[model samples]
Target: MPDVQDCLPTALYRAAQVRELDARLIAAGTPGFELMQRAARAAWRALRRHWPQADEVTVLAGRGNNAGDGYLLAALAQRAGWRVRVLAVGDPAQLGGDAALACAEARAAGVAILPWSECAPLTGVLVDALLGTGLSGAVREPYAQAIRLLNASGQPVLAVDIPSGLCADTGRVLGVAVRAELTVTFIGLKLGLFCLDGPDHCGALAFADLQADPRLLATGVPAAQRLTGAGLPALAPRPRNGHKGLFGHVLVVGGDSGFGGAALLAAESCLRSGAGLVSLATRGEYVAALLARRPEVMARGVRSANEIQDLAAAADVLVLGPGIGQGAWARSLLSGLGALDKPQVWDADALNLLAAGQLTAPAGNWLVTPHPGEAARLLGTTTAAVQADRPAAALALARQLNALVVLKGLGSLVATPSGELYLCDRGHPAMAGAGLGDVLAGLLGALLAQGLTMTAAAQLGVWLHACAGERLGRAGRGLVAADLMTSIRDLLEEHSPCLK
Candidate 1:
């Protein structure tokens, strides 16, 4: 079998959708108990492969089908000559259907079954089958206590599907959750495992398809698509006779006083990412400095909104925000952009100003990139609320503004006004730094200027930016925003080469 990472499916489904898929699979000739058996065998093989030296196994079983998988795994382990014991968190009398059958099989195989308690000793590899994707509320009772103990045990844990307390639809941790070193999931890939708190709790992820029919799987629509190299939109190769005029021009507007570097970073990123002509309209004080730093950019020191009118008129795409403060000068510049109907990428203070009600969202093809705080401001909610359900927040903002939204965070999302959603899981924690958003905004503008549609540009730009950070992140910390420009250029070339 291929490694989990090597064979990951592009489609991401909500928990309910996955359950529906499960039902559909069972209805299409596969029996429920047989599916459970397959799940157990898949997880068992993963556990042995991940920790071959372990001779003992402890199973934490609940009452549902998830528990059935655990009980069946215990039987397999016992039969293989490995010492195995099951700590039943849910009462055995409560189990019905296949779970009861699994328990009987475990007993027949001589697997020791014990009720869970605080005093029970945990040994060998711990299997967390306490809760599954069906959990919608906070964990309660002995299950919560069991999850807490599992987290504190310092034992290597392999979660049966998802970590017990993770919200499979949203990736939110419901009050408390078990942190597993390796999570072997079955059937479909849950959206929760790749976003928010999911990545932190699910350490090394593995997946098994359980031999579901591909044609049947295709009948269900996924909630979102994970961004991968296989089907990403790409720029067409440049013709040999292509000239600077053949590509479009991009104008970056922002940089209020002390925030000049932000606009410069955007302009530099735009130029390197293949914008034919990149210009910066900012405070006059930074013109000479911008020229000195990157002479390729046509840097202009604009004092008022009127100064940017000509630049905007000539530009094919505009990148707004990026250190544009919310003062008189920033307002003036924003006012100048009000009448322009060109495609734009809004970020940083531009989003802040919009959230502050300084201006109505312009009518045209545009994209807004907002972090969690900015997203909250735009949605008229708290940052915590936006973080709690990022996908919902992103879609809401996109629909409300009638524009594409790139909700930048751990699992960055690109949401279209039409309700299409794409997620980028390629970034690293080391990318948590300043000015990265600026680079992203600039790259987005360049892609738009080069003729990609709003949705296509947002998806490709986000993937390239995150992939660049992932590559640079391998060196550890101390990663600055400027470091991604070259890597992004390289990735863009690799994805869409200049020569055919």
Candidate 2:
């Protein structure tokens, strides 16, 4: 079996979409049973490689074809002269088609087949073949019990296709899912694997296409495009004659009172991400500190909306609301910018103010970066609801606001007004602290100011930000918000150098 990690698939599909692809493959000459065998072989190969010394196996089997994969794997283990047991959590009498055939083959091969009971000893490497991509609702009845047992087994567990009791579409834990050490997914890459609860449940994911026809795959459109080095778009190369004014001016307006650092972070990002001229319109008290910190930026101590208006008039792009509190000052800035034609990126409290009805969502040429909580506020929903389907929430935000949306967290989703969605599955947990959003907002501003379209800026900024975080996260833990600034420029140059 080939290592799926080496040759990764960029297109992600819903569970139903993967099932459709499976049906299409079966229709295109590969038998369903044969595909199941291929899947089992892939899982077995991954399992052996993962736990080479663990020969003994306990497979939790259900009624569906997922059970078929388990049964077939038990037979494969038996043939390899390894001890194997198939605990039938699903009634064997109800097993149908390929699954029934697989059960018969496993039994004839002298594999120990026992009805799953509470007392069944879960030993060696546990195989979670209980439920696959077909699960639509909560893990019910005996399957739920089996999933609980598999989780509690405390043994090395390998999930077939996906972790049992996890939603294949939304990555929602369906009444609790198996905590598999390795999850071998088949056919197509499911969208649920990287977002929400998916990453928590799926320890490590491996994909096997089961030798599907390339022509068959060509007929299907992906639900969302995955952002990778191979597929990402970067800034175009700069000519040797490029100068400071060539990249456009960026105005970062935020940093109310105590949150002065938020605005400064964005300002630093502007200079780092190739913004030719950067201006900062922040609280009066922060001016000396910002100017001393970064002399490249023209830091202004803006007392009123009138002063910000003067800066907004001359700037090419605006990054608003890094540390802008939901006070009189924030409202005045929003009202002043209401008439500006410049492209903008709004984040942090800007989203909060928008959700709170204090600010109007701009029509177009603006990008909004919101975490789940901010997204929920903007959508008039709860954080749980937003997390349930992040992709959908992102799209809704874009459509409702008629602006480009970056729903930040986990697999950060970028949605455009034209209905394009891109997922950046980069970044590290170490990059999960305060002030990150401010950095992202500032980076987005620089990208847009460099003359990238709303979609291009959102996508590229997110990729660069996440990729930088990933590169720096190697140091391990305590990754603060300000750490991303310099690496961003390094990566930007590496990815799309200014000079040819």
Candidate 3:
């Protein structure tokens, strides 16, 4: 499939939207059967390219258009002198329209079709075509049993359109989903394929538009957009005479006694991410360590919220949270910053405090980056509920709080108060560490300080952060949060060069 992650279309749609696009394509002169044939050919080509040595095939067919694609592919493989057989999970008599025509074609080509049984003796690359994107409920009966067997078969598998039992809208597994080695999706890209459980089940993804007209496809609205390097907002180049004062000052307020590293990581990221002046308002004891670590940062030990007034007034933006515990000191610091009118980026304990009702969110010009757990608290729901439909959760958080929101996770989402949603499909498992969120919070503050709008900063900061982690993640396990700082700085320069 050639790793089409960067080349895929950014506009992601729900299942119904994709069906609408398919209908439009069919209405515009292309026969439905012809479209099915094209889809089959696309999947066939991808399969051949992916598994060139495999000469035999076993297809699990269910009576839908998805099964039609499989039947047609089986016919193609049969004609090409390869052994092919179809285990009809969906009764052949139940097939209709294009699917019925496809089954007849397979039979005409002398391909063996048999009923699905518990002991089907599966062999050769398995093809999953049991369900299409129209699936909304959990799998039932024999199909679920077939899916379980396919998963346990220990054979390479290819899913037609979408993997059966995987929600095409929310990537949530419905009872059981076929885990395919390669998934060839047709028409439009489903939002579920890139987020939540989608990536794990879909494996290597390949998309085929089925020759649909670009104009017709553009008419439909997208549910959300996948962030790509070319489409992201960029920072302008700095002038030759630009100095420290030209870029805004960023004040990082957090770092309780025990979790001083969290606040320091944020301050360091801010300094490296082009914030002209970065100041840290943390515990008195950590000041010496921070200064010794990064003397460029103006690190100060403040005992109370009253001590932060002068610093807050002088700063252009504030990055609150990282390492701020839920103790009295943290609460007092958060309470003091509540009245400040500056643009702020809140993370970690700041979100916790707000979720606990200890702090009332300020009116505007602020953003919050929270993981699923924190987001659940903010929404008065469970983390599992929040993760079930991340797009909805992020949009709801943005609208409810009336603030820019970055729901951080595998497929991190950036949501605006106006309901615009952007998803970042970058980053790797290697980034599953403690201090990464702190670094992201700092990076967001730096972008805001450097004059990017809250929306632009959130989107660009997330892209940079994810891409940096992805690049560093190449080294594999043991990727520390500090490892991302230098890579992010380089990526930022590459994304928006220092010089024009």
Minimum summed lDDT over a 10-residue window in model 3 is located at 1-10
Over 312-419, each residue of candidate 2 has an lDDT whose tens digit, in order, gives 988999898999999998999877585577798888998899888888766567889999999999999999999888888888888898999999998999998778
Query: lDDT by residue for model 1 over 1-500, one digit each (tens)?
Result: 11125368888999988999999998999999999999999999999999989999999999998999999999999999998999999999899999999999999999999999998988899999888999999999899999999899999999999999999988899999999999999888898898899999999989898989998889999989998876789899999999987788999999998999999999999988899999899998999998999999999988888888999999999999988999989888987585588999999999999999996788869899999999999999999999888888999999999999999998899999889989987889999999999999999999998989999999999999999998899899999999999999998988899899
Query: For candidate 2, what is the total of clashing residue pairs?
Result: 0
Error of 2 at 70 (Å): 1.1
- By the TM-score metric, which is better: model 1 or model 2? 1
In candidate 3, the residue pairs with backbone N, CA or C atoms under 3 Å apart (3 or more residues apart, or in different chains) clash, namely none
Candidate 2: give the clashing pairs: none
**Which parts of model 1 are misplaced by more than 4 Å?**
1-6
lDDT of 3 by residue, 1-500 (tens): 01237868999999999999999988898999999999999999999999999999999999999999999999999999998999999999999999999999999999999999998978999999899898988999899999999999999999998999999988989989999999999888999998899989999999999988899999999999999888889999999999999899999998998999999999999999999999999999999999999999999999888898899999999999999999899998889686689999999999999999999898889999999999999999999999889999999999999999999998899999998999998888999998999999999999999999999999999989998988889899999999999999999998899999
Kindly report the root-mean-square deviation of model 3 from the true structure over all alpha carbons: 1.6
